[model samples]
Target chain A: MGKNLREPLLKLLIEQKEGYISGEEISQRLICSRTAIWKHINELRSEGYQIEAKPKAGYRLVYRPDRVAPEELIPHLSTTSIGRAVRYQRSVPSTQSLAHEWAKEGAQEGSLYLTEEQTAGRGRMGRIWHSPTHSGIWMSLILRPPIPLNQSPQLTLLTSVAITRALRKQTNLPIQIKWPNDLLIHGKKVCGILTELRGEQDQVHYVVQGIGINVNATESVWPEELRPIATSLAIEGGRTFSRPELIGAICGELETLYDGYLSYGFTPIRILWEEYAGMLGQEVTARTGQGSVKGIAKGLAETGALLLETHTGVQTIFSSDIEW
Target chain B: MGKNLREPLLKLLIEQKEGYISGEEISQRLICSRTAIWKHINELRSEGYQIEAKPKAGYRLVYRPDRVAPEELIPHLSTTSIGRAVRYQRSVPSTQSLAHEWAKEGAQEGSLYLTEEQTAGRGRMGRIWHSPTHSGIWMSLILRPPIPLNQSPQLTLLTSVAITRALRKQTNLPIQIKWPNDLLIHGKKVCGILTELRGEQDQVHYVVQGIGINVNATESVWPEELRPIATSLAIEGGRTFSRPELIGAICGELETLYDGYLSYGFTPIRILWEEYAGMLGQEVTARTGQGSVKGIAKGLAETGALLLETHTGVQTIFSSDIEW
Candidate 1:
């Protein structure tokens, strides 16, 4: 069968999720032979799709493997712009790098880059993020909001709120956000956000928000050093969650929050973030480029800088690594 | 003549600027035949180098072109970092565009991109800047400063001070800076600075500072709409200036100011900018994304935001278009 039929076939199967579709009906709808349908089903199976075939029942999708292909996420997406266009790769060095290139090439707002594995995954401060294949959500989004260049960091905090809300809704795991952007489950790091931007002195041109989530990976996926500090949904929740469903929920929540931000300002995001913050009102030490400061985590400033109450006064931490 | 010998030949001619080098001496120094030396001299002459050739005296460097080639600016440059590595193009759409590309490719700090003309020159707020061939200083510099992302705009203001100081020393044309970055001569804009940056949410990775100067262009360079607002050094000073010399001076001044900025902070830059600012204490209207606000231009905030004293109170304008 033609490669173009793969997406239509997947969509057809998704639309008929309650029942099976006969091979003759699928072949007729796809303008192909039954043998071609059989071959395509085999291809899909190889890509980790579980398709049950019975003599009279024809074909039924039993389960979808943890893949973030557009076809897999399309049916679950509820946002108009967030996932309207997605570039999927089985493996990449970094989705953030690709997102930057696409943004420079004038990619529309809300364009997304999703990868199954990132051979050279990147985290904040140039740290390495381990993204294994078929086990996590490694994605980057391109946003062109009309915000001042200095206020761009608020989007990172806003994204943390979006992801936390989505994770809580999907897995019922008490996911919480650290001061700026790290998402935690059971007091361990589960997600990290890296926000990069290009802009003029006053106006922001585009922002690339990269999110790496540990979804279904087991303990072996992480190195020994990270084994104690890192965790996944399966490890923490004791149940596997669909990667596509999680991505779809995150995108939808982000779109709603982003719209609210554009209309009502950062107050909504700030409130949501404060509610989901796991470190608020706690004594923490923030290590910055200048030096380290110990203070109580009050909340985020209007511009998303962490407001730390210290001995000196109320200090706004623009960028730093936090430890409680 | 081999292209590789061109730079050495030019250097030799420059070293013999007071007198002339014999044809035999030139051929011997450059490791080429006398005939080859003659051909290379002809090529240099075609590139606007006034090489005086005498039967017995040989070749003398009478006058260097207004080009901003590395060789032309090398002798005039006195800085350690700025303009150390030069990328020259005869004609480009915009040095700013090329600078962004080079910055992403790991272009080091102080890498300079100079173009004789910018076919699609840009100004602040997406306006068109007139960059005529061989009559303007059209260049971009890549800088990687270790500063918070919110403080990035200070570099733009610092650059204005650098350019104003340089132009004052070179042309003595009473250059003044408009709020943010427009350099005005006699209330007409003679230079504009466009500062672009790429960075994380908190720290800046790199900044591309694009400076467009209307140097030697006459009244014909400006469009009808820009005629009343634009002026050049030649028109204001009534004499043409060397583009390479101006570039070298500006780069040197920028390096000095940037070093001071990273050490003592934005205080010195703010003090100098306040001195050179023409609109200080004047009533002006700033058109921001939200709306317009009229106020007295008090000065710049600590983070380089325009501090505007309005009837309501002092407002820190992060991004806006200002008019008097």
Candidate 2:
């Protein structure tokens, strides 16, 4: 019922090696009823983890499913509370939409959002993001930074740094971050991040970073035609990688980078992002609202905008869809 | 219903001389129905207008409402399309809240919002705005401009220009716009504006302009002490003005200025706003989140930020609550 209940239960279940635990021990330590423990277990099942239980043997979490659940994920996270609060929804129209609303209604800082499905998910071009129920990780991170609105593009680099570092740390599959907001595997799309901001004149209240990664989704789960162009971690890894582990690692990485940026500016994250951005120094094209322009990518400016050295001059692209 | 529906109805109803007409006439000419006519009529009544009816005499408009409504107010409104789309709620918690939700739902450009009451109104200094039910114009404008995020503060100046023009044109009561976001009546406060932006990295998605004006509210409406610092349009004019008329006029003015900004930019509105800002040359004390400072108001910068010539230098305040 409370956001705290699931967290302690998750830590308890993880520590018990056989995944078998007596309900009595959990009740004595956490000071909750066996019924409360069962309820959270049921909630965890609803969020897609598998548990085997017997009346006499108590409950046994036999399968820690690769799914997004705060309780199962947060305990393993090595974070300084950048994403200390995890809000998970069974299904939402858009993670960014719900995150934006929650941020306005006074959601806490570093609130990490996870949704099993996004019915009306959004992409960069105001297009519908296809989030076929529980097939991928669809979530948004809400960050309230003490920074100017113009400096917000720096957050894109910061998030790329966090996500790229997280993927590198948790998975063996090679993931490359393209300029702006793309993640690719073997040059096929694997993930995308869209950062939206709300502010007072020039002060940014919060940035809702929506990241959708194709995880265990196979070709069958994807739309028929998209199978050729899109991929998931399962396809790339030849096995289903753990979603909770990936999410936990991402939250920790994000927290570390966000804290660093707030304290010391974007220098730390910017350096890391440059390493992961494979499109730097390559022939690139950007599709702005005006029109598409081709240029040699000259890396990013200190402000985090993409520096596209064009035929005329170097243009700082504050926003665009990148192709390299 | 679309906001433009009322403008033609206002003209047609006025031509009938008598304020009363049969529901059949409205339905027949407008190709609507008796039910729709009655529904909109009921809506106009909630906005504080009085109507009378008899079987043979049909319906008679006993008195024009003082509050803002689409029908009576939109007729006199002059603009291409700003006030053309109007939505009104009698007792919403806040107009800004309504506008924000609507914006996400793909509400159109130049949408005009008005509310009779705000259960939780807000002021610049995180203070509660005294908005008695049916006592003030608690409204917000939702705009989706083509400009980048940095150019958004000009919207505040554009909004001030529209509001000041509407107040001057309607009341002859003469009001001045204080730097940042307050509208002054003689010496006391009459209106306030809160501008919030939603952007994509560096591109602005939408801007919600929240405006609260004390129209028909009396001194008694204020908690005993606030009477000295706050005054209403009704008190200043010595007569209750129709809020619907004023609302329509302001929407019209806003549309004009908004169009002016899109076509010609904020230079015109900036010049116009400077004339009404009386503290431009005066020594004033400002309390910001950083601290308090005594400075002379040099003028407004090109981007609509107030240029405060402090002891250190001319600081451009992009976001702050100013009290003079």
- What's the lDDT for all of these models? 0.90, 0.78
lDDT tens readout by residue for model 1, B137-188 = 9999999999878889899999999999999999998999997879998899
- What docking class should model 1 receive? medium
Candidate 1 Cα deviation (angstroms), residue B299: 2.1
- The model with the greatest DockQ is 1
Looking at candidate 1 chain B, the ten consecutive residues that score lowest on lDDT are B41-50
Q: List-wise, what DockQ does each model earn?
A: 0.56, 0.35
Query: What pairs collide in candidate 1?
Result: none
